[model samples]
Target: MRASLIQIAVDPDESVDSRRRRAAALVREQSGADLVVLPELWPTGAFAYDLFAAEAEPLVGGPTYEVMAEAAADAGVWLHAGSIVERGAGFDGPLYNTSLVFSPAGELTRTYRKIHRFGFDKGEAVMMAAGAELVTVPLPEATLGLATCYDLRFPELFRGLVDAGADVLVIPAGWPERRRAHWTLLARARAVENQSYVLAVGTAGTHADVRQAGHSIAVDPWGEVLAEAGSGEQVLTVDLDLTGLGVTREQFPALKDRVLGLAEPRR
Candidate 1:
């Protein structure tokens, strides 16, 4: 399956509407790709916590959703339109860092609200409500396990997706440049351990005084990096060999040997 990871550069000068239109155009450009993925919070820079409330849109029929749905239909591809700051319910209701997935027909297939909110006590942690459910989207080629930026650090979340029969992990992040190494390391680790394809897309350039880590990477089941972007806006496209995933798992069979429900370490 062919996939395109759009590493968008969230410029501070760009208006949210401009970025939304540009993102939709980019998605439309990937006409032949089976799947196209974008970075997290592309509308407003992820670290731009103050703008969250101003830019937050409804879960459905929002500007981002409307444009991206049309883009998916125009390109005839499955599009993971990254994430948006979702305003839940009525006035003063909770906000959510939500990821959206659209089918080729422009239908809203699945939505994954970011489970692991970023900031500990401030920023997103306090501003947004945590999502309780784990979401997986079933595609014609592969089943995708949805995760956001901070969620990548938690192995248990990925494991849960695997348990639910996810072979392709699609993580959209707005990771900072300071922790680029961890981003790459953790992405590879997730793919290697899960024996699945990892499509980790992140933002580029600077926003909210934080430079984004633009090394949007794709890792195969064997832990090999297939494609990676630089510290700028780029589209890293790769052809994923889904059939080889089963071969890698069959050869190593590490997943089958997992010992669950072990007793706590002798303390």
Candidate 2:
């Protein structure tokens, strides 16, 4: 399957409306790709926590959904439109950081509200309600495990995804430049450990005084980096063989030896 990762340059100065149009144009350019992925919270910068409430929209009828659905249909590709500030229905609490996936025919296929919010006590943790479910998108070519920026740091989540029969792990991040090494390292680790392809799409440029680490990467099941983008706005496209996951896992068989019940949750 061919995938295009769009590393967008998010600027605090640019309006959300302008960025939405720009992102749609970019998605429309990838006509032949099987999948098109965008970075986390590209409409508004992830670090721009103050704007989350003001910009939050409903899941189905939001502006982001409208633009991305059309773009996906036009490009004839499965589009992972990345995380959004979701203003949910009947939600008296904070909004959710939700990820949306669109089918080739411009239909909303699946949604994953970010389970792990980054900031411990402040920012998203305080501003948004955490999601409880693990989500995976089932496509004809491959089953994709959905994850967001901070979710990459947790390996157990990826493990659970693999248990659910996911062969490709899709992560959309807005990681900071200071911790870029962690971003790259963790991505490869996840790929190697899970024995699945890791498609991590991150953002470029600066927002909220934090420079984004834009090394959007694609790692094979063997932990080899297939493609890595620089710290700029560009599309990183790579053709992947989904069948490699089974081959690698069958040869290694390390995942079968995993020990369960090692750590217990606190009461």
Candidate 3:
């Protein structure tokens, strides 16, 4: 399956409306790709926490959702439209960092609200509601496990997805440029441990106080990097074999050795 990861530049000067149109156009450009993925919160910069409230919209009728759905239909590809700042029922209620998936027919296939908020006490942790459930979406060639930025720090979540029959892990992140090494390391680790393909797509340029890490990457099941983009706005495309996931797992058989017994108390 061929996948295209769009590493968008979230400049502070760019308007939300302009970014939405640009993103949709980029998705449309990947007409031959089986899947197209975007970075996290491209419409409103992820670290632009103050704007979340004002920009939040309902998941069903949100502008990002509407534009991306049409883009997926036009491209005839499965599109992971990164994430959006979702406003729930009440305007005064907590918002969510929600990721959306659209099928080739422009139908909303699945949605995953980011489980781990980035900020510890302030920012998203305090403002947004955390998602409880893990989500996985089935494609024509592979089952995708959904995750967002901070969620990469949690290994148990990826393991759970693997156990749930996920062959590919799709992570949409808006990680800072300062921690680019960690981003690449964690992505590779997740793929190696889970024996699944990892497609980690991140943002580029600077947004307010944060400078995004734009090294969008695709790693195969064997922990080999297939494609990686520079710290700029570009589409990184790669052809991944979904069958290789099972082949690697069968050949290595390491995941099958997992033990879940309770740890013995010390001294």
Please tell me which predicted candidate would have the highest lDDT against the true structure.
1
In the predicted model 3, the residue pairs found to clash are: none
What CA RMSD would candidate 1 show?
Answer: 0.8
* Candidate 1 runs further than 4 Å off: none
lDDT of 2 by residue, 1-267 (tens): 999999999988899999999999999999989999999999999989889988998999889999999999999999999989999886554699999999999999999999999988998888889988889999999999999999999899999999998889999999999999999999999999999999999999987999999999999999999999999998999999877777888899999998877888799
Predicted structure 1, TM vs. truth: 0.99
Model 3 bad stretches (over 4 Å)? none
Model 1: lDDT equals 0.95
TM-score of each: 0.99, 0.96, 0.98
What local lDDT score does residue 206 receive in model 2, on the 0 to 100 scale? 89
Angstrom error of the Cα, residue 53, model 1: value is: 0.6
Across residues 140-174, which tens digit of lDDT does each residue of candidate 1 receive?
A: 99999999999999999999999899999999999
Better of 2 and 3 by TM-score: 3
> After aligning candidate 2 to the native by TM-score, how far in Å is the CA of 76 from where it should be?
0.7
- Among all windows of 10 consecutive residues in model 2, the one with the lowest summed lDDT is 87-96
- Backbone clash tally (model 2): 0
